[model samples]
Target: MTPAARLSAAIDLIDIIDAQRIPAAKALKEWGTAHRYAGSGDRAAISGLIWDVLRRQSSAAWLMEDDSARARLLGMLRLERDMDVATIAALCDGGRFAPDTLTDGERAALTSRTLDAAPAHVAGDYPEWLDPYLAKAFGDDRAAEATAMASRAPLDLRVNTLKGKREKILPRLSHLGAVETPWSPLGLRIALGADARNPGVHSEEDFIKGAIEVQDEGSQLAALFSAAKPGEQVIDLCAGAGGKTLALAAMMGGKGRLIATDHDKRQLAPIHERLSRAGVHNCEVRTPRGEADALSDIKASADLVLIDAPCTGTGTWRRNPDAKWRMRPGALEVRLKDQAEVLDRAAPLVKPGGRIAYITCSVLPDENGDQVRAFVARHPEFSVQPPEQTASVLWDKAEDFAKAALQSDEGWLMTPRRTGTDGFFVSVLRKL
Candidate 1:
C-alpha cells in the first residue's frame, strides 16, 4: 500500500477509537480483519501512524487548531515524523487512495505553528487533568518530563546470569546494534526508529537457549534494589508474567526459595514456560484457588517481599501511549485502592527485620511517595530504608545515581527525563 493510503487508514481508525471509546489495538485489529488485502507491512505502517497520533495527540491538536483526525495525523507528521510542509503535501496530494489536498489553512498552520505559547498539557502531549499530579512530581520541569514520556522507547533486554555473563551475550547480539544500558548491568538496549520493525530476537539461538529476557532497564533496576541474595527466601507478591520473578531468580542464583504468585491466575500463564526456559529450579509457582489463600502455608518466612504494585502506568506511556488517553480519574482511585490492599498483604509475609521493596511504574505522588508514607503510617513497625543503602548495589555510581533520581524521605523516583528510564519509584521498608 502507498504511504498516503496507510495514513488515510490510520485517520479512519482513530475516528473509530474516539467514537466507540475502544482501545487502539482493538480498532486496529478490526480494521485488519476487514481489510485482508492489506499486507503485514501495510498494517504495521498504519498502526505506527495511529500510535504516533496517540502519543502526539495534544500537541498536534494544539498545532493544527483542530482536533479532527486528519489534522492530528497531519500535524504529527510535522512534529513526530519531522516532515516539512512540502513533504507532507506530496503525500496528501488528491489521488486514488490518497488523502485530499492540503487546505490553505492547514498549510499556513503547519508552516507557522509552534509550541512556544502552548500550555503545559499541549507541550507535553499529556492529558490536561494530569497537570497537577505532574507538577507535584516534577515541579516546573513537568512538561519536559512528560515530553520524554511521550517519545518512543528503546528495546531493553536483561541478560540471564543463570545462563551467561553480560560480556558473553553482548557480543552475540551485536549484529542488532545492542549496547549496554547505563543503569542496569544486566541490561542491553536496541534503539528503534519510528517505523522500524523489531529484530526477531526470539528466533536467535541465545534467546532460544534462555540467555536473555526482554525486560525494561527500569524494571531491572527495581528488582536490583531489592538485593535478593542466594539462600534467602523471597516472595514476589505480584509477579505478573515473571519479569521480576526471573530477575529475582537470577539474583538468587538458584540457591534461595523464590515463590511467585499473583491474585490473578491468568497473568501467571506465561510464567511457567519462562521459568522453565530460563532453567530456573529453586522457584515455585502458586496459583490462587477459589477464594482461598495461595500463601497460607508460608507465614513470616520471607527475607524479602517485592511488590511491583498495580498502577496507572504513567511511566510506561512512551510504550503504551493509548493507555494514557484511556485512563480516567476513577482509574487512579481504583489503582490506589489495589496498591494499598497489596501492600497490606505483603506486611504479614515478611519476617522480623525482613525488607519489602515497594515499586510502581507510576510517576504520580499519590501512588509513589504518598502511598509509601501511608503504608509506613499504618505499620509503625516498618521504616523506610535510606536511599544510600538502596543505591549501594550500584557501587561506585551510587552517589551519582542518588543525585540523579528524586530522593524523598519515602524513596527514590526515576523518570525518563531524570534517569533515562521508564517512570519508576522504588523504596525499601524494613520490619522492625
Candidate 2:
C-alpha cells in the first residue's frame, strides 16, 4: 500500500480505539483480519503510525490545536517523523485510498505551532494528573524524563548462560544487527525502525536450542540486583511467566535451589515451557491451590526472595502507550494495595540476613521508593540495602552502574533517559 493509504488506515484505527475503547492491538488485528488484502508491510506501516500518534498524543493535540485523529497524525508527522508541511499535504491529498486534502486550518496550525507554551503534561505526552508523581520521582526534569520514555524502545535479548555465552551467540544472530547492551553483560539489543515488524527470534536456531531469551535490559539488571549466588536458596515470589526467574537461574549457575511461584496460576502456565526451553533444572514450579500455602515447606529459609511486584507499569509506556492513556486513579490505588500485600507476604520467606529484592517496572515513586519506604516501616526487621552495596556483584562496573542510575532514598531507579532501558526500580532489603 502507498504511505498515504497507510496513514488513512491509522486514522481509522485511532477512531475505533477512541470510540470502542478497545486496545490498539485488538483493533489492529481485527482490521487485519477484515482487510486480508493489506500485506504485512502495509499493516506494519499502519501500526507504526498508530503507535507514533499515541506516544505523542498530548503533544500532538497541543500542537495542532485539535484533538481529532487527523489533527494528531498531522502534528505527529511534523514533530515526530520530521515530515514537512508539503510532504504531509501530498500524503493527505484527496486521491483514491488516501486521506482528504489537508484543511487550511490544519496546514496553518502545523506550520505555526510550537510546544513552548504547552503545559508540562502536554509537552511530555503523559497524563496531566501524573505530573506530581513524575515530579516526585524526577524533580524539575520530569517532563524531559517522560518525553524520553515516550520514544520507541529497542528489542533486547539476554543470552542464557545456562546454555551459551554472548560471544558464541553474537555471531549466530549477526544478521539481525544485534549489539551488546550498554550495561548488561548478558544482554544484546536489536534496534527497531518505525515500521519494522518484530523479528521472529523464537524461530531462530539459537533460541530453539535454548541459548537466548527476549528480556528487557532493565529487567535483566533488576534480576541481577538480587545478587543470588551459587548454592543459595532463592524464592521468586511473583514469578509471572518466569522472565526474571530464568535470569536468576543463570545467575545461580545451576547450583542453587530456586522456587518459582505466583498467586495467580494463570500467569504461571507459560513458565513451565519457558523454564524447560531455557534448560533450567535447579528451579521448582509452585502453583497455589485453594486456601493452600505454596511455600509452606520453605518459609524463612530462602537466601533471596525476589518480588517482581505488580505495578502500574508506567515505565513500560515506550512499548504500551495505550495503557498509559487507559490507566485510571483507581487502578493505581489498587496496585498500591497489591504491592503492600506482596511485600508483607514476602517478609516471612527471607531468612535472617537474607534479602528481598523489590522490583517494579514503574517510574512512579508511589509504586517504587514510596512503597519500599513503607515496607521497611511496617517490617521493622528489614532494612533497605544501599543500591551500590547490592550491586557489588557487578564488580568493577558497580560504581559506573550506580552513577548511571538515579539513587533515591529507597533504591536505584533506571529510566529510558538515564539507562536506556525500561523504567525499573530495584531495592534490596535485608532481614535483620
Worst 10 residues of 1 by lDDT: 192-201
Reference-based TM-score of each model: 0.97, 0.98
214-261 per-residue lDDT for model 1 (tens digits):
988999999999999999999999998999999999999999899999
Cα RMSDs, all models: 1.4, 1.2
Q: List the residue pairs that clash in candidate 2.
A: none
> Which ranges of candidate 2 are over 4 A from the true structure?
none
* CA deviation > 4 Å runs, candidate 1: none
Instruction: Give candidate 2's error at residue 358 in angstroms.
Output: 0.3
Which candidate number has the best lDDT? 1
Q: What does candidate 2's lDDT look like per residue over 130-246, in tens digits?
A: 889998888878888988898889999999999999998999899999999989999999999988988889999999988999999999999998989999999999999999999
